[model samples]
Target: MVTRKGEQTKALILEKASKLFNSQGYRASSISDIMHETGLRKGGIYNHFENKEEIMLSAFSFSIDTMSHFFSEAMAGKQGCMERLLSIISVFEGIAERELFPGGCPIMNAAIEADDADLLLQEKVREAMDGLLGMVRNLVQEGIKKGEVKQGVDPEFVATVFISTLEGALALSKLYKNQEYMKRAVHHLRSFLAQNCA
Candidate 1:
């Protein structure tokens, strides 16, 4: 069993590593980078993790969890599909405005970098993406059942468009060192949701 201090150390390591991996390409980030970021010696880090791959994946999961926490906070007490969806978009906007991840959305960052990365890493990205999509799809279905969304709207398509547009806009916003790109996407999304889902 892990001791309390051990658990704390592991969490610290994951937190630092997640930021490092997101800022630097995961594959490009070496064990030395993680050690440097966490201020932990090789033995210190290796004590909690079996290998670099373990650390990498764990860190990736940590990043996703961070984003999920924000989503949960934003959507709390919200009712109906449009409100919930707008809350989600607001969360994404906050990501850019607050500079939540200096390297952009970790899932998109890792997935884009995973083209030449390990197959396991690629598969992990797919699983993470699928989970995000599933959440949005479920929200759309619930909205449909509640008679908020237009009849026969496809959950799969809504999830894809919502995520894809927001992610692309985020990247552009980051690249240009401006928030207007994200604001524009959010505006367009709000209009689309109001028309189609209201």
Candidate 2:
């Protein structure tokens, strides 16, 4: 029973900390902030995590899992590469609309926050992004293997372009607090996929 309660407390800390970190830049969010967010004093938080860095790592992992869950749900019935990729775009659009992960993309936020200053966090961000890009690349490859996408289409190029476009548009949308940028991105990506991937 004590073990279960401890686990519960740890989860609570992670949930609140992740939201706090995402909303406020991770580097700017202090231990005091996390303590306040979790409604736990220093000891209470330290009981679960050794330090701010540890909490940041765990919270970042939690964010990645949360994002992945949304993607999996969006792609549930999607079969074709274009279909799956569009679903992915819809997820990004949903982000711009604040339907998910309210503070913005975790990977993007973390990358900007930790760039050049925090080696560990930077590595984590890179790994997360690689996974995201790989997912797109694999989908494109599958499309070609099934003859749904044009022969000789470069999955590598497609993945890079696909993610950069969506992330860039998402950043713009977030900056303007308008969903139009994401909507425009989705529009162009759909057409790009249909024409180029065809």
Provide the TM-score for each candidate, comma-separated: 0.94, 0.96
lDDT of 2 by residue, 34-109 (tens): 8888888999999888888999999999999999999999999887888899899988988878779778898899
Q: Name the top TM-score candidate.
A: 2
Candidate 1 per-residue lDDT over residues 61-134, each given as its tens digit? 99999988988988999988898898889878877875577788888998888775488888889998998889
Candidate 1 C-alpha error for residue 101, in Å? 2.1
lDDT for predicted candidate 2 compared with the true structure: 0.90
Candidate 2, superposed: residue stretches over 4 Å from native: none
Residue pair clashes in candidate 1: none
Give the lDDT of residue 163 in candidate 2. Answer: 94
Model 2 clash count equals 0
C-alpha lDDT of residue 82 in model 1: 90
